[model samples]
Structures are given as C-alpha cells and as structure tokens.
Target: MGRRLRRAGRRAPAVAANADGRLEVFALAPGGSALHHRWQEAPGGAWAAAWQPFGTAAGGAPRVVRDGSGRLTVAAPAPSGVAVFHRRQTVPSGGWGEWQHLFGWSDAAPALAPSADGRLEAFALSPGGARLVHRWYADPAGTWAAAREFGEPGAPLAATPTAAADATGRIHVFAVTADGRIRTRVQERPSGGSGPWNAFGERLVAPLPAGTPAC
Candidate 1:
C-alpha cells in the first residue's frame, strides 16, 4: 500500500474537488507528513472538507462524510477491506457496528471521496503501477462500477494524487508531476453524443514562479 508517504521534509497535502472542477487546499499540521480529509457539499451547496485526526486511522481515512440528504455518515475501513462504522442508524449500542471490508486493499493506499450526489468513490493507483483508477459502489452492498482512469499514461513520479469531489459530482484529481510541477485533471460527462471520452484535459494545477534566478 503506497500511502501518502510524504518525503521526510515534504508534507503531503489533503485534496478534494468542487463543482467548478477546482481543487481546494487545506492546512496541515506543522512537520506533519500525511493528511486525510473528506469532501462534502455543504448546506449552502459548497465544497467543504472534514479533516480526520492526523495520523490516526481509527475510524479509517475519513471519520465522517455527507450523505445524499446531507446527514453525516461516519464510516471506517476495516482490515478485511470492508467499509464499516457507526452512524445514527447503526442498530443497538453506541452507534457502532461490525467492520465491513468494502474494497480490499490496494497497495497504492486507497482514498475515499463522497461524490456530489453522496455516493462514495474510492481511488487507488494500480498496485503494480500501470493506471490511476476510481471505483464507485452505491452503498456497502452496492455493486462496484468498473475502474476508471484518473489521469493519462504517465505515472505520478514525484508526488502522489490527492482526490476531491465537487458540488456537481464531477471529480478533480491533483498530483505532483514528474518534474515537480503541480498538475490537475478532471472527468466530465459528455456534453453531447457519446462517441468517446473527449471531455477531459490537463492543465497546470499550481504554476511555478514565472521568473527564476540564473544558475
């Protein structure tokens, strides 16, 4: 599992998507290496992040998320690869339940995202390192959609991808390019006939300073 695994001095930032297809940034604990956060469309219909305790996987990557009705869903990833957690509807006891191994482990270290419509989508880089993929299943019992590529053929050489969802349910992904450049890409439903997936493109996510000192 390739977790965010930030380099010694580099802090891996949390990422999430917005309806405008924009990726938003969050503050990190000083000297902290990894970040885990959830993307939810707030009451006014804006993207907001719910950050999990730094370095704590107790309730899994995201301790909470927004359900379709905007109710908070607290779920956790289990060792058995199931998604399980306690919510207001959990049954008897203190709002907890048996662990459910939703999606088995991906060596790439999986990240969970709640889409605009409230469906949970998980993205992981191929264990063997070939493609960046996204898989979605409605609820715990929902069938998983086939894996979708999040980026072009090139691998994220230096930086890892942090995922996010927008108010419209579109997905935005951010990653550090091979040359240390920040790059972002998004997936969009075809605006017209379904000839092919011609609705995607890549652009500089965070452009580097335009001027530089001569070596």
Candidate 2:
C-alpha cells in the first residue's frame, strides 16, 4: 500500500527508506536556504513535520541515500560554492553525525548512491555546470578519495547529473550533453570508483540554451 505524502513547504525532496521500513525525506526548506527533513515512523504512519536536519543552509537540491548497513547519508550544495556538506545517520534508531564538508566547486545539486560494497558515491556538476565531477569514500566512515572530473574538461553540461547503482554494484551516471543527447559514465568498481564515461549519442530532448540548462 502507498499514499502521497505531504509537507506544507518543501522542495526537491530526496527520499530513502531505512532497513526497518521507515521512509525519510530530505528537502530544501521553505525559505530555500536550509535543509529540512521529515520521516515515517512506520509503513503507514503519518509524515512528520519538516525540521532542520543539521541547522545548515543549502544552496541546491538535497540528495539522500541509504548505504548497505541502512545508514543514511545526505549531500547538498552548500550556500558557499566551495564545498558540499553531508550528514550521516549512523543508526536506524536515529543518531545522526554532524555535518561534514566535501570541498569541491559545484554549480548544481549533487546526487548520491550506495555502492555494492555499502559505501557511498556522490556526483555533481562542476562550476558553471560545464563539467561532471564525482568522488567516494572507501567506506561510510572512511576517508574520501580525490574528486575526479568525467568527460573532457570544458565539456558543456546540458543538465544536472543523476546516478544509480545496479544490482551488480556498477554505478552509472546520466546527464544531458551539450548537444541535447544523454550521456553516462560507469564506475567499474563496487566500492565507488568510476570507469570511462560513455555517451548514448542519441538526442533525448531538445538542447536547452547555454547557461540556463535544467537538470
């Protein structure tokens, strides 16, 4: 069974269900300057009222995903473009860690997906949305590896990047190329490392005007 959940004021919500079946939704707060969250206590319970997750203002859409162990991690564009801030819920019972910074310059919101080995991988558009950048940690609590850009530098981005992990643990990133075609990059490793990016070369939609692209 399912129903449309409602919050009086939220935008670009990112949802993830915990191992115990509770649904957690993170969104840009009403003011559009902070992160707000709501969650289900059980399968059919009423959604909680929006509340700030970490008292931090968010500059872009928030992304949330659950790792293999059911821990929840969230990433959003910081009000400052110099970094992205993330918070992790270490336990299902609700002990969330303090917000941590991942330094990288992103002009668009970020995406998060759990790797096959239970770690988390993050993707975002570079400054001016002209490049795709990604990074991941060895584990939820481990050190983060270096950030790497995909595709050729200066390649124009037609939209914000989205990512997903298949059953086999391969991570795939999808985005609109400057020519209005869809493109993808695959991460060969299950632990969040990416392989070469591959483009579909087929125009999926009309190209947007440069500098005003949609994700």
In order, candidate lDDTs are 0.40, 0.67
Each candidate's root-mean-square deviation in Å? Answer: 10.6, 4.2
**Every model's TM-score:** 0.44, 0.82
Please provide the root mean square deviation of candidate 1 (C-alpha atoms, Å). Answer: 10.6
Report the error of model 1 at residue 108, Å: 5.7
Q: On residues 13-103, what C-alpha lDDT tens digit does candidate 1 reach at each position?
A: 4343333333433323433333344334442365444544433233223333333433333333332323232222143111223334443
TM-score of 1: 0.44
| Pairs that clash in candidate 2 | none
How well is each residue in 89-118 modelled by candidate 2, as lDDT tens digits?
868548688888764777445777778877
Q: What is the lDDT of candidate 1?
A: 0.40
